[model samples]
Target chain A: MTDVNSVRPQARAETSVRPEEVLLPPVDVIEDAAGITLFADLPGVSRDRLGVHIEGDSLTIEGRILLPAPEGLEPIHTEVGLAVYRRVFTLSKELDPDRVAAEFNQGVLKLRIPKVEHAQPRRIAVQVA
Target chain B: MFYRSLFPRDVLAELDRLQRGMQQQGDVSPSIRGTGRGGYPAMNVGSTAQSVEIHAFAPGLDPASLDVQLDKGVLTIAGERPGVLPPKEAPATVHIDERFSGRFRRVVTLPDDVDPNAVSARYTDGVLHVSVQRRAAAQPRRINVV
Candidate 1:
C-alpha cells in the first residue's frame, strides 16, 4: 500500500520548481439542488495531461502545459510571462466520493462533487395521525 | 494464472519474469493535458447563459491561414502563425525571440446540446472568439404566464 503522506510531500516539493503553475484562477463554487460545482482555470493544458486524484479528504489537480517555443528568429531575449497552471484543493467531508466528476474544456476545469446522501436535505412524507 | 490457458509457453514465461521486475514508478504526469503546454498558441474561454465563448490568444495567425471547424460537437481551432524575422545572424552572444509563430491546433469538445450551426466566430483585438449557442431544447425558455 502506498503511503500518501510520504508521497504527497514529494509531489508538493516538485510543484515548487514551477510555482507559477500554481496559478489557480478564482474558483466559483456553487452549491445547488443538484450538486457542488467548482470552476477552475487550466490554461495550455491538454485533455490527456489534466490530472485529478482523490484520496480520502484530499483532491489534487495538476497539469504541466508547455508553451510553444518562440519561432522565426532565435530567442535573443526571452521572458515567459505565463507557462502553465496547477492547483490542488482539499475535499470537504460532505463530498460524495462516488459522485465526484470533472471536465476540462476551453481552459476551464469543472468539478461536480455531490454531497453525501445523508448530508443532503431530504423531504419526509407526513401522515395525518 | 487464468490467462495462461490462452498464451503460448514462451510468452507466458516472459510474463512471469516481467511481473517480478515491475515496480510502482509513482505517478508520471497529469491525466489532463496541457500539463506540458506545448507548441500551440494560447486560447481563452468564457461561458454565459447564452453561449460559451472561446478565444485564441494569437497575434500572428493570418486571416487567410486560419481555419475554424465545428464537427460532431467538437470545436477545432487551427491556424498557421508565420514567424517573424526568420532568424538572422547577430553580434556576439545575441539571442532573439518573438512570442507568436508556427502552426497551432486547439480542439475542444462541446456539450451534447450545443448548436453547431448557430455558432459565431470572429477574430478581433488579436483574439479569435468562437461563440457556441446552446440548443433550443437545452436553453432556458420562459414560460408564458397566460
Candidate 2:
C-alpha cells in the first residue's frame, strides 16, 4: 500500500485552516476528453487581485476577498466577513502547461487546460485504402 | 450564495424599524445587512472559441456599482452596494442580515495568454458576467480535421 505518512504533512496544512474560516471558495471540477475545468465563486473579487501559478504537477490559486465594510459610523457589532482563498491541485499526466488558460468574471474564477492530445481517445478510422 | 431578500415581508419590517432607529441615533445607516454568508452566490464558468466566460451570483450588485480591472494576469472586482431601500427618515433596524454591503472585493487570476484589452463585463438579472478573450496566437488551431 502507498505510504500515507509520507504525505501526511501536506494534507495537514490544508485542514489546519483556522476554525472561524471557511474552505477556499467552493470549486467545481468537470472533466471531458480535453481536460479538466475548475470554477470557484469569489464575489467582490476582480482581475487585479487574482493570481494563478503552476509548478510541476501542482497548481495554485491565490485570491483575496475584502469584506465590504458598511459606510458611515463605526462598525459597531461588526460581522463583516473577510476572506482569502488559497487552493492547490495535483494535475494528472494529461495536463499540458502550454495550453492552460484562466479567466475571472464578476466573482467567479475559471480555468481551462487542454489535455495532451495523445492522452485522449482516437476515433480510430478504418483504412479503406 | 444566498442573501435573503430585503423585500421579504419579515426583512422589510425589520428594515423599517432599523431606519427609524438609525435616524434616532443620528447615523447614516445602511438599509440592510446579512448576518452570515447569505448562503452563497451561484457561479458558472465555461469557454468559447475565442474567450472564457465567468458568471457570479450577486443579485443586489449591479453593473454600475461594479468595478473591474485586470493586471499581471489577475482580474479583480470591487464596488459598493449602496442601500437599496428608499431614503427614510427613521433609523434603520437590521433584523435579518440578507443584503451584503460595504467595500467588497474579489480577485482572480487569468491564464497567461489572456489579452486583458479584450476583456468585457456585463450584468443582467443581478448576475455579473465577464468575458475574457484569448490572443489568436495563444490558442492552437486545428491542424487537421477528419
Candidate 3:
C-alpha cells in the first residue's frame, strides 16, 4: 500500500568515528493502525549509558557497553570486543515525535511512535438522505 | 488433466530458503578479533590467576529462563529469546526485523585447572557473567631471592 511505503523509514546512515568498532544493533520495526513500535537489542548497556535522540525527521539511538573485565584479568579468548552501538532512522512525516514513548528492559529498548491525529484511521458515519 | 514438471520452481525456491536459514544459524567461527559473524549472544572469555570469567551479550531474556551448566570441562549456556514481532494476521508492516529469537546455546571448553565446584553465574542488565575459579595449585606464586 502507498500508506505503508510512506510510513516505513529508510535505511540508517552511519556518520560517527571512534577507535573501537561501532556496532549496529539488531532492530525490529512494526507498524500497526495506531503507530509504529521499534525494538532494539543492546546488551550490556545500562539505563544511564543509553541515549535516544530525535532531531527533525531523524531518530538516533546510541549506547555503549559498560561491562568491563575485572582488574587482574587477562583475555585468553575474546569474541566480542568493547564497542559502541549507534543507529539512526528517518521518521515519516505522519508520525508524531513529541508523543513518542520509550521503555528499556533486559538490555532491550522499545520505542512507540504514534501517528498524528489527522493521519490515523477514522470511520465515517453514513446517513439516509 | 495437465502434468506438472518434476522440479517445480516454488519447490526449488523453498529448498534454497531452507539452506540459507541453516547457514545463518551456524555462522559462528572461533576467532579473537570478534569478526562480527558469530551467531546470537556474542561472548568474551577472560581469565585471572584466581578465576576464569565469561560474559555473554544476550538481551531481552528472563533471568530464570537461562541455563548454565558445566560438566566434563565443558561449559554450556542455553536460553531462548521470545520473538517480539506482531502477529501475522495483524494489519502491521514490518520494515526491519533483525533481532535474533528462538533457542540458542553456546558451549566453551574450560581448562583442566579450573575448579568446577566453585563456578558462579549471574545475569544482570541482559548480560550473563559466569566465573569459574581455578585450583590453588595452578595459581602462580612469587619466589623470594636469597
Candidate 4:
C-alpha cells in the first residue's frame, strides 16, 4: 500500500485578502493501475469560477459558490451559506502531472491523473526448463 | 473499545465537544443526527409574503433523475449518484475514497400555511430551487384606516 502521508501536500499560507471564508471541499481520490482520479463536490460553482492549478509538487483547487438572494424575500432559515472552496494535495513522482485532465459539470469537478509508463503493472512471462 | 472503556467519561465529553463544534459550523443538519458526516448538500429555507423558497446545494446529479415530492407539508428530495470512477475500466487499487455516493433522501416539513397545489421547482447549475406559494388567507394584506 502507498503511504498517503508521504505524498500529501502541505497547505501554504493564505495570501489572498478575500473577505469570504474558505471551505474545505469534500473529495474522493481513486487510484487504479493506470493512475489516480479525484472528484470534488463544489456546489453552486460555475465553470468560470473554478480554478485548478499545479505548481511544483502541489495541486490546488479553488472555487467560489455564489447564490444570489431573490428579490423581496426574507431569509427565515439558512443552512448552507455562501463561501469559497479551497484545497491542496501533493503529487507523487510516480504519476505524470502533464497528463492531468479535468472536467466540471453540475457543480462537481473530476480530475484524471495518469501514471508514468513504468508505474503501471505488467504481466510476466514464464520460462520453461 | 478498550480506549473507550478506559476513558468513558473523557470519550463522551470529547464526542459532545465535537458535536457542538460541528453544529456551530453549520456543517451537519440537526435532523440527521449521528450520521456525523458534514453537510453534503447544504440547504437554505426562506419565506416571502406570497411564497416560500428552498434552495438545496446539490450538484452533479442527473436533472431527470432528481426526485422532488410534496406530501402532507413535507418535501423530499432524493437521487442517486453513480461512482466517480469510470464504469468501463476496472480499478486495480483505490487509495483514498472520501466522496459519498449511492442514493440519498432528505425530507423537510414545510410550513402549515403552504399551498400544496401551487408549487414549482427548477434545477440550475448544481442548486435546486423550490418555490411554494402560501395560502391566500395566509398572505398578508394591507388594512384600511377609517
Judged by TM-score, which candidate is best? 3
DockQ for all models, in order? 0.01, 0.02, 0.60, 0.49
Output the number of the lDDT-best candidate.
Answer: 3
The order of the candidates by DockQ, greatest first, is 3, 4, 2, 1
Error of 3 at B37 (Å): 4.3
TM-score of chain A of each: 0.65, 0.69, 0.77, 0.74
Taking all chains together, each candidate's TM-score versus the true structure is 0.39, 0.41, 0.78, 0.75
**Top DockQ hit:** 3
User: What TM-score does the first chain of candidate 2 have?
Assistant: 0.69
Q: Write candidate 3's Cα lDDT for B1-146 as tens digits.
A: 26877888999999999987786565466335333446778888899999999999999899899999999988988989999887898889999999999999888888899998999888877899999999999999998999
What TM-score does each model's chain B reach against the true chain B? 0.65, 0.59, 0.74, 0.73
Ordering by TM-score = 3, 4, 2, 1
Report the error of model 4 at residue B85, Å.
Answer: 5.1
Indicate the DockQ of the complex predicted as candidate 4: 0.49
TM-score of 2: 0.41
Q: For model 2, what is the alpha-carbon lDDT of residue B2?
A: 82
lDDT of 2 by residue, B12-130 (tens): 88989997676556435442432222323334445555676665556455577678888988777777755432234533322223344467766555667888889878775345767
Task: Single out the weakest 10-residue window by summed lDDT for candidate 3 chain B.
Answer: B28-37
Better of 2 and 4 by DockQ: 4
